[model samples]
Structure formats: C-alpha cells, structure tokens
Target: MAETEGKFDFAIDRGGTFTDVFARLPDGRERVLKLLSRDPQNYKDAPTEGIRRVLEEESGRLFPRDQPVDTALIGWIRMGTTVATNALLEREGERTALLVSASQCYPPLPFPCCWPCNNERISVGLRSHKGRKEYDLQRH
Candidate 1:
C-alpha cells in the first residue's frame, strides 16, 4: 500500500464576540488561536495578527530551520457580516418613499411611525385620484 501523505490547512472565524483560528501542518500537528473581538478597529487588525502568529508557530512546528514550504495549495475564505443591518438600524438607510391609499391619506398620523413625517402621508395616481374626490381630513 502507498504511504498516505498528510496536508497543511488553516481556518479562521470572526464572530460578533470572538475570533477563533485553527492551523494544521503536514506533520499532523495542529495549533488553535483565539482572541476577543474588538468592535470596529479589531475588525481590521485581529485577523492579520492571528494569521501572523499562526504562520510563525506553524513554521516552527513543521519546517524547523530554513526549510522551503510549498507555496501552492488550496485556500478558503468565508465572511459573514451584519454591517448592513446595523447601518439600517442606525437610521442610515437610503431615502425611501411610502405608498398609501388615497382615501386614508391622513388618519391623525400614527405617532413614531416608520414613514417619513415631513411629507404627505398619502399618495395616489392622477387617474384614480381624479376619478375619485378629495375631502378635508380635518373636517372628517
């Protein structure tokens, strides 16, 4: 039977609260690294430092001294983010329009509603509104 050769691999995970890493070398040895997540700034620096440490430790574990490691191999990257949702929640979403039925244009305006307050709450097409009629909401 042919001798099975081992492989080297690395994995990093960044979550809302932590960063985790795992690395393995051809010699069947592995290393795990973890660090607390710092919001905003850490998002940029933590991964880089984690990768540097992994490389240093992996080099010593598999290729002691001046050994040339293979440079060609499979690599994977996966990223999940909540930045968009956060931005929207922060009221940074794009300007949006609301379409309300003409008849119910203004019903005392719900307090603290998601729709914009500065503009007319109700909007309808020319044909429909023309055929129908407009009544003073204040009177009704």
Candidate 2:
C-alpha cells in the first residue's frame, strides 16, 4: 500500500440495519467497511466509526474514539441513506407535496408524464396555459 499523499474520498451508504463505507485514498487505493447502524454500546454512529477505522489504517495511527476525526485529511464525502424510504414505509415522517407547472407547446412534455416512482401518496400534475390539462392528478 502506498503512503498517503493527499486527502481521502469516501462514499457511504447508511441503511436501516447496516452502514457501508467505501474509501479512496490519495494513492488511488480503495478500502471498504461495513458495520451495524445502531451499535450504541461501542460507537455512537456507524458511518463516523467506519470512517475513523479506515483513516486509522491509512495513517497508521490510533485515533481516540471519543475525539473527533481530523477533517483536514478528508477530501470529500458522499453519503446516501434509506431513511426516507424507511420513514415512508413506517409512516413516521412529515408529509411533503410538490407542485410543478410547465408549458406544453414550446417544449413538449414527455409522453407518460407520470413517473414510475409515483405511489398512492405521490403524484405529478401537468397543466398548460392554453386551457388544456395534459395530466391531472386526482387526489384520493
């Protein structure tokens, strides 16, 4: 493994049951880690703990679990989580709705305007100023 020269880049996925981390060091080396998402006994956050562990191995130093990790060594971090999906499935979060409008003649709207991701609670509506409604959502 080549020694660290610059900052490290990390991509993380935090799921309901587990958190997975993928790191790319300055030397173009990659590392991965997976841990329980809710392990409060040993660590407060799984993603942070996973990053700390990777950094320790990359820098060959023991980072105190209580102390914050050195942000200077991190170039960037991209994270994704399933919290929204979990919340929607469990009906635990605040409801949100979005309304969008656009012209239909100038730049025609795509056919099948409704997205496949739409569910009973989500919808897409289209209305033209020409007094013609292309897609009208009926809320139940």
Best by TM-score: 2
lDDT of 2 by residue, 1-140 (tens): 23335778899999999999999987788998899999999999999999999999889988888999998888888999998768766767654433333332335433333233323444547777587546555644
Per-model C-alpha lDDT, please?
0.50, 0.76
For residues 45-122, write the lDDT of model 1, one tens digit per residue.
Answer: 454455555655655644322344343421433344454445445656543334344455566443233343343545
What candidate 2 gets wrong by more than 4 Å, as runs, is 1-5, 94-140
Clash totals for all candidate models = 0, 0
Ten-residue region with minimum lDDT total, candidate 1: 131-140
**Reference-based lDDT, residue 19, model 1:** 69
If scored against the real structure, what TM-score would every candidate get? 0.38, 0.63
